[model samples]
Target: MTFTPHILESALLLLATFLIGCAIGFVLRRFLAKPSKLVSTKAEAPVGAKPQKKVAAASPTKAAPAKKGARPAARKQTPPQSDSAESQAIDAGTEEDDLKKISGIGPKLENELKASGILTYAQIAGWSARTIDEMDAKLNARGRIKRDDWVRQAKALNKAKASA
Candidate 1:
């Protein structure tokens, strides 16, 4: 077959039509699409809510006292408690509840608590607000104690243990 002006004109018209069709399809797809709920919705704090900070758990070991003329390394502070409830020392080597039984506490958190000398529900039940805040901070739970109401759960668990 020989190339001719008529065939060339027909081929060019067909290519132009195809390109125009693609452009229209693209525009329609973009303009007519509805937003997907899953893709569009994002987790955002409500306006006017206070922002919260999360810290990672600190090492359980205590450091030696700093020598004079040396700056001490910044350490995670153990919360000071004026209340007598937590003034009693946490008992070690005693039979203890599986702290993982509490919601939001995993085996890692349970081990962390045990390492910190918190082996029993009785000890948790005796925590003052300061102690709770300290423990929450130490665990890096990011307000989980307050959110999960662990103190209430601990008190109930302690009472239950007493009876059983």
Candidate 2:
């Protein structure tokens, strides 16, 4: 089939219009999307190290203007006493375990767990159902601990560590 100039021009115009529409849609979505409030400002502490407490600065009566498209500053809150108690129970000068040994735990997950003060296999082995649920929400694991049978694995690993 022979191509006509009119057909070629129409196809080019349609493609140009589609490209421009896509660009506009992308820009609109980028600027109009709501910012997430779960931004974490705390730096990750090394495994087995105690997490530092953050001191809150007094807020001014007037708020400063935020830059367009910049994320809002993360608000700092005092950590629950239960978290510190849990950490203290497991810590006790014990060396940190490699949590990645547990099924479904990777480097990222291990780091997150360490940041939350879960540093030893004993801790994972000791979690009850309620503790697991609290961890699920805290780590955003969505029942991954139960799904992966992390408790059983942790028990075995802890036993092996103890034996060795």
Candidate 3:
């Protein structure tokens, strides 16, 4: 209550504390920045004799802390039916058809089918009993394939294409 005489001293002390805090924060930030990758010069060796190993980029000594309220990296997406249909037609490299021709297969359903590696009628027509279950699960169709007889329609379409 009687610091009027020492007002200047109190102000100086406060200023020093703030300056020290700022300096410490700056140093910490500098130390935390990612280090630049090091590249070795290749001119010392013969031009075309043999290539030399690159200086391995150093890993961070400390893992970067996750930011507050930030989400983790998204999970990697797998190709549809990769496990079951690897031999089916994920990369059949054949001409795709308008799956929308099927009664229940709308544009959205067609896209879902395409995303699940069902491009041609032949692929759908060839679905095995096990494959039907897997595809049904993937599409969340609630057994719509069985209900709508998509296999029969696909077989018909496949036959028509073969005839043409």
Candidate 4:
């Protein structure tokens, strides 16, 4: 039962299990292989890609028509009409074309009183019809300063601007 040194010790234990499975597949392909530019779980983004346009803002230019006694002066104090002109450009001394001398102000309620800081006619003649019905119940304005009939229409336009 010695057949040529037991087939040379079973061919040296099958060449030491194929050289220990090629030295454990060359040390797991030199530490778990991977990285020949392969991080692609699919998001490289150029196959017909078309998503990025946003740029459009440039319109304001038209000015030149306000003079007649260059008006604006009648504000004898009482100012703070609920803080609006972007809530802090609070000069409120009056401008934004003095909200077109209020026969019921326009241009979208003068951009909703310059977006709520009531830009001027001396802060809508220092408001107070319960602060123009709490800014016409928070900007649904439309009642055109009917903030409960704006303090008797701002005391009849300040008694017709103090008898003109």
Candidate 5:
């Protein structure tokens, strides 16, 4: 084939365009990618690593000064009676029930429940209508608790445990 300057120029331009595009992609991948922090509160420690005890801070630190146009840092609202009181009840030597035994609760849901301080069938059994709504919202259950009748199951389970 005869070497035509027009075809050669077109091929050269295409190659140059491809190389520029690849260089831009490499730069973007290197500089724009960010490492995300884990959203889960309970992260598993590495194997053979000793668990660190959490030391309570003597006093709360003051909030940092906010910049103009910057939104305030979101504060985690403490759950009312459900979390605090239930955790206290567990701390008082109440044996934690196998929450997974209840219908519709799996290992993941049980972990979420435990994270929210739900430790006993008694706690699930004693949920009021308002508390159920609160828990549904907290767990993002969207009425699963009510639909699954976890309270009824918990009551029966607790009673069975008592009898045995």
Candidate 6:
């Protein structure tokens, strides 16, 4: 039932044979085998081979200038005309110090107000409830009427103008 030297010798011999087989397999894989089909067909380009030059594109020819007899196209650069009656009215007001001096009044509004016949501070101060209502209606119809407080501002501006 005890272990014997012969069994140990047999085990050592099997181990040595297995190691030799592995070494032989490693040597075959490294040197003796053919290259894979995926690799064997593709060859590296020669280092001294000349690279192909890319062709430059030809430049496009310019068109000849138009003849002198031809009429030049007229540029239509008219300033935008407001169709809004209130804006037109506001724009027509005078260049007076009081009318133009109002904070929100601009050149266009001044012109419109002038066109509407609201020319002076006295005219603004003289505006009756009916006149204001009418102006308001015209302004509202135009859709470009300013803030509702414009009348008050205009009135104040007119008062300031009169006192000065």
Clashes of each: 0, 0, 0, 3, 0, 21
Clashing pairs in 3: none
Off by over 4 Å in 1: 1-88
Task: Report the alpha-carbon TM-score of model 1 versus the true structure.
Answer: 0.46
In order, what lDDT does every prediction score?
Answer: 0.76, 0.81, 0.78, 0.60, 0.80, 0.60
Candidate 4 — worst ten consecutive residues by lDDT sum?
81-90
Q: Candidate 6 at 83: error in angstroms?
A: 26
Tell me how candidate 1 scores on lDDT: 0.76
lDDT of 3 by residue, 1-164 (tens): 88876998989999999999999999998999788888986534311124567897778986798899999989998775433532465454688999999878888889988876678898888877767777777777889888888889999998999999
State the lDDT of candidate 6 residue by residue for 1-164, as single tens digits. 75788899999999999999999999999898998767566653422224588997866676567898999889999975433322223344355544666555678767766666567655555554545555666444342224444556667877776688
Instruction: Order the numbered candidates by lDDT, best leading.
Output: 2, 5, 3, 1, 6, 4
To one decimal, what is the Cα RMSD in angstroms of model 4 from the true structure? 23.1
For each candidate in turn, the TM-score is 0.46, 0.55, 0.47, 0.24, 0.49, 0.33
Off by over 4 Å in 2: 1-8, 15-92
Candidate 5 residue lDDT tens string, 1-164: 66798899999999999999999999998999896776988855422234588997765477566799998779999775433223334565677899999998999889988877789998888887877777777678888999999999999999999999
Any residue pairs clashing in model 1, and if so which? Answer: none
Candidate 3 lDDT score relative to the true structure: 0.78
- All candidates in order of TM-score, best leading: 2, 5, 3, 1, 6, 4
Task: Give the number of the best model, judged by lDDT.
Answer: 2
Q: What does the lDDT read for residue 98 in candidate 4?
A: 45
Off by over 4 Å in 6: 1-95, 140-146
For model 1, residues 74-105, the per-residue Cα lDDT tens digits are 99889864443324456555777888877788
Best-performing candidate as measured by TM-score: 2
The sequence of per-residue lDDT tens digits that candidate 4 reaches over residues 56-155 is 7765666566789898669788865433223234554534544544666558766866656555444455654455655675667667577345435445
